[model samples]
Each structure stands twice: as C-alpha cells, then as structure tokens.
Target: MHEDTAYPLYNRPWFSVWLDAGGNITMKGILAPAIKPFTSDLLDLFENEKPIGTIDANGMIVADGEQLIFSTWMPPIPSAAFDRLTRSQFNARLGKNTPDQVTISVTEECPNRCIHCALPDTDNRESLSPDAVKDVIDQVIGMGTT
Candidate 1:
C-alpha cells in the first residue's frame, strides 16, 4: 500500500534490487526509463507509470506451500529480434550490481519547527523502539547502504 509519486518513471536510468537474509525482499530504485514505440505492448504495460503495472514489473510473489516467496524482476528482452545494442545495454546495467540508498525514519517527530519540512504533520508522531532502531541501523549497514 506504499505509494510515492514525487518521482516518475520517465526520469531514471537504472534500478537495483536484492533480498535480505531474513527473506525480506527490499527493492529501492530510481524511476524506470520511458518506453519506446518499438517496445512490445506486453512489456510496455509492465513499464507504465501506474503503480499496479509498475509494481508487477518490479515485484513478484510466489506461493510455496505455506510460505510466500517474494522477488523483483530484471529487465526482460522483448523478443529475439531485439537489437544487439539494446540487449547489451540490459546486460551492462544489470551487471552494475550495487546497493541502493536505504532510508529509515527512526522518529517521525522533529522538535524543530522548520518551514521547509515535507512531513505531513510533525506533532504527536510515533517513533521506532530503541531496539528496532538499532536493528534497522545494523541491517542497513550490513546491506552496504551509502
């Protein structure tokens, strides 16, 4: 149910996805590149700016007995007729494997009353438990977030 529209799919050049040791799949990436007219309609649907389609293109859930396995998608070739340059581009981008930025809000409340803040509201906000904060910091550090 998470939705962020500040960044649109037409602006990004790449994305990165990975799964944590606890089986928690975290996908943090830039907006997707635009679709060209030459692209397949089926694949174009996957690249749409709408959340439903974009999420489908970026995420997957597999049912395995009692467990729900989750993962993200890599760039898919539209067809064998696709040019060699485009195929090589996909390979190069996918091979540029690195960690994306990890943003964790330890506290929703900021004592300062700054006018430039984007928070919907600053009052009576809930903060994460100390142990939870510690855990998140440790996890992000281990994941190599810069």
Candidate 2:
C-alpha cells in the first residue's frame, strides 16, 4: 500500500482530523506505529489540548501548511431518532425553541428473553401499570417533550 501524498487530508503524519455531519470534530488515529517510541509526553498534550484548525461549512479545512477536505462517518441512527436529533440541532444553532424527543424506559420485563438478548435476562423485574405509563408520558409531555 502506498501513501497518497497528493492529498494530505487523512494522511497526517501523527493524527488526522475528521468532521462529522453533526458538526463534531474528532481525530482519526492519534497513536500511529511510527510515533510509539516518542509518545510518553505527547499523550498528555493530546488529551488536554484541543487541536487548533479552521474548518469552513463548505467542507474545506485548513490544518498545518495546507488546506484539505476530510471524510467522516456517522453510525446508523434510527430514522425517528435521527429526525429528532436533526430538529434539536437546528433549533439549538438558530436559538429557536423546540420539543426534544423523550425516551422513557417503560418496561424492562421482556416476554421473550432470547439467547442473544441485549437486556438483562431477569424475570424479577416489575413493569409499570398502564396508568403509570400514561402518567409518565403526560409528565414528559408537559416538560416539553411533546
């Protein structure tokens, strides 16, 4: 494999920067094999200091000596949740008020506790009554989760 020197976006010697769609910045790989020997003091600097760089909305970034365009990944967020997050982000950035989606743990008692279940397979957990659940929903809605 050859390193593409033509484009230095993700080819930084030590660490490369990536920007996500939600306007979040993160480093690709801060610990490279070549820098393993000289990382004693560098590790602290990476943890405490924020990377200084300029990124524009056009997807262009200025880091080090050159300007580059970087790529980022976003894990699959469920459509409903993604819509809520997008709406909340837009409202936050624009100083607008909006209702954020509320996630309530209604029940932990699963009828089908399969072999590969994500939740704990405990049968002693008690589920909330329908009235209790409704009250919780009403309370959340009153708090602006509507």
* lDDT, model 1, position 31: 30
RMSD (Cα, Å) for all candidates, in order, is 18.1, 15.1
Task: Locate the minimum summed-lDDT window of 10 residues in model 1.
Answer: 62-71
Among all windows of 10 consecutive residues in model 2, the one with the lowest summed lDDT is 1-10
lDDT of each: 0.37, 0.42
Q: Pairing residues by index, what is the TM-score of model 2?
A: 0.28
Clash number for candidate 1: 0
lDDT of 2 at 137: 78
Q: Report the lDDT tens digits of candidate 1 across residue range 55-131.
A: 22334432211111222222212212122323444444557433444556677676765686655464558889999
TM-score of 1: 0.28
Best of the candidates, lDDT = 2
How would you encode candidate 2's per-residue C-alpha lDDT over 1-146 as one tens digit per residue? 01122222123556643333323434446554444344334233233233333343443553432322221221112223333434454455567665665555567777775777655656567778899989987875554443
